[model samples]
Target: MSAADADTVLFIPGLWIHSDSWAPWAALYEKAGYTAIVEGWPGQAATPAETRRNPAPLDGVGLEAITEHYARLILQLPAVPVVIGHSFGGVVAQKLLARGLASRAVAVDPGPIKGVTKLPFAQIRSALPVVKSKKNRSTTVALTRKQFRFGFGNALPKSESDALFSRWAIPGPGRPLFEATEAKKTDKSPAQIDTRLADRGPLLIIGGGKDHTVPEVVTRQEFELYDTPAITDYKVFADRGHSLVFDSNWKQIADYTLSWVAAHRVNA
Candidate 1:
């Protein structure tokens, strides 16, 4: 499709992996006549290998900083793009919508935002590795293979889970987690969502039924927060986990998101 006719879809990745995490999704979006751009957090290395080898690049990064980086990128787009984000990137997508930056947004297994009080035991346990350390706020931390298996890859077979961990797992900034944990106490926390905004574009929240990180409970709570359910939608992929984007059934979710965007394209 020509640039003028093509819709831009910006893919925002969450913790651990960089922009490359969205490579497969980008290709799919492009095949559907959308111009896809996979962007990373500020200071994120180009690849998982590079970030694994040197994590200092992500030190001291926080949620607000990452949000600002993405907001700036959205402002530079030719038109308001369809912003799709996974994990913490999902949180950023909502922030962008609050700023009137996206034509539409899809948040998959999104990290919790302020006012989302339902923190399940699984979610807390999954985040313990990062939140356990106060110094992690200023450092980069990598999850152990076992931790990755439990928190992100539990729904997949051992071989596939191991392969995904090897290919995509990398050090992630801890400050974002810290920021999320303290969001309730902080005014204007980055995790705060402006659910009351009437002009905020349509949003779709996708959840994994078996997800240990951002479980269905969390996604449901997020969905209920929207004052206008007409523009907000939620779906759960049963048998999937936090790593749904990298799972074999990822295309199913992608196809749904594409259809949702197509349905709402007239607004763009």
Candidate 2:
């Protein structure tokens, strides 16, 4: 099919990362014969600077709203789109797949979901500032450069880490981290997903071995949580960190996702 008549790929950005950062990935996907779209969360500003200046709208935005936003968008699409999401977006990608919205999904370094029990120290430290108090659940938070370095850019040099932060970082809601951290204990948690959907689209969960924010162990646990007969796969980048999505070599991850989607969606 020509690119215009081919499938659409919806790209979802994770927390603290601007939606516009997905532009490069969108171009890459379009070149591979797919229509690409990247959207921001509910109440999110169009640009990083605008959102940084007035983040009030994003303070209380949580997974439910974000999920609904994408679901509504998916319904209006020309066809069931292939969804690829990173970090919290990863969580949403799986949720969308469970809800029968996407034809196939690739979740890279996704946030911890309801059934994940293991929380590494680095994950805890990265999230403690926001998940420590109940009030933070309704507030917006921005990561410090140092925190970003540790959680996302640990595997990259300081100069590139700083550049990525300056270019793509933005304030985001804290509810996801809070809800995910306490997901197992919360009733009707937004982080919950139906892992037993045997007829749903295929899923590929990617992990970053050097990811401090969402450790590779957590990604494996999430992969293990699926109890269905549906296809579920997991892959790990042994030397990469959470910043794999937007770092200098982000195309590596994007290309892998493109290949996976092509292989799996053929039977989806």
Q: Give Cα-based local distance difference scores for all models.
A: 0.86, 0.89
| 133 Cα displacement, candidate 2 (Å) | 3.2
- Candidate 2 C-alpha error for residue 59, in Å: 1.0
TM-score, every prediction: 0.95, 0.96
Per-residue lDDT over 1-107 for candidate 2, one digit per residue giving the tens place of the 0 to 100 score: 11121289999999999989889899999998899989999978999989899989998889999999999998887677889899999999999989878888999
> Model 1, range 1-268, lDDT digits (tens) per residue?
1122128899998888667868889999999888999999988888888888888978989888998998888777777788999999999998887777787889999999998888899999999999998999999989999999999999999888888899889899999899889988999887898898876778899999999988899999988888864488888888889999876778888888989888866342
Least well predicted 10-residue stretch by lDDT in candidate 2: 1-10
Using lDDT as the measure, which candidate wins?
Answer: 2
Candidate 2 clash pair list = none
**Where does candidate 1 have its weakest 10-residue lDDT segment?**
1-10
